[model samples]
Target: MTDIALVRVTFDTAAEADRIARHAIGERLAACVNIDRPCTSIFRWRDVVETAEEVTATFKTTITLASALAERIAALHRYDQPVIESWPVAVDTAVAQWIDDATHA
Candidate 1:
C-alpha cells in the first residue's frame, strides 16, 4: 500500500463543490480535485430516506495530510453529515510518481 489516498466527498450543489475545491487547492491541502456534477445520491438521513442531486469531489493528497484535508472540507461543506471517504491508490510507478508530484506541487 502507498502512503497516500484518494478522498471522495459529495456536496449538495456545484457552488459548494467549487468552493471546497478552490479552498483545498489554494491551501495546498490537495494537489487536484475532480468534481462530478449533478449526480443523484440516495441515502438515509435522520431516519428518513432521501434522494438528492449532488456534486462529487475527488481529492488527491497524501495520507499524512488526509486528516487536515478532511477537516477543511467538513468546515466548508454545508451538509450536517457530509460524505467523506478515502481509499488507497495502487498503481504502477509512473502513476504513483504523478500522484506524488501533483500532491506536492
Candidate 2:
C-alpha cells in the first residue's frame, strides 16, 4: 500500500477533460493526468437509463491531496453531478515517494 491515489473522472468531451487535466497538473493538485480513449457509459439518470460517449480522465496524486483535487474538479465540471472517484494505489517505493513529493505544495 502507498500514500498515493488514482482518481478517475469522466467528461462529456475531450476538450473538457483536457481543461481539467491542464489545471490540475499545472496547479500541482495532480502529479499527472491521462485522458483515455472515448468510451460509452450507460447508467440511470432522472429515472431513465441513458447512454453517452464519455472520455475517461485519470489523475495521479497523493491521498492527502485527493479530496481537494476532487473538489476542485467538481467546481470546474459542467455536469450537474460529475463522477469523481479515488482509490489507493499499490505503487513501488520510488513511485510512491515521487507521488508524495510531486503532489506536495
Clashing pairs in 1: none
Q: How would you encode candidate 1's per-residue C-alpha lDDT over 14-90 as one tens digit per residue?
A: 88888988998888788888998688989888899999888898998877788889999999889887879988776
TM-score, prediction 1: 0.85
Residues 1-105 of candidate 2 have per-residue lDDT tens digits of: 566899999999999999999999888899889999999999999999999999999999988899999999999999999989999878888898887777776
**Model 1, CA-based lDDT:** 0.83
Give per-model CA RMSD: 2.0, 1.1
Clashing pairs in 2: none
- The local distance difference test score of each candidate is 0.83, 0.92
Best-performing candidate as measured by TM-score: 2
User: How many clashing residue pairs appear in each of the predictions shown?
Assistant: 0, 0
Measured against the true structure, the TM-scores of the candidates, in listed sequence, are: 0.85, 0.94
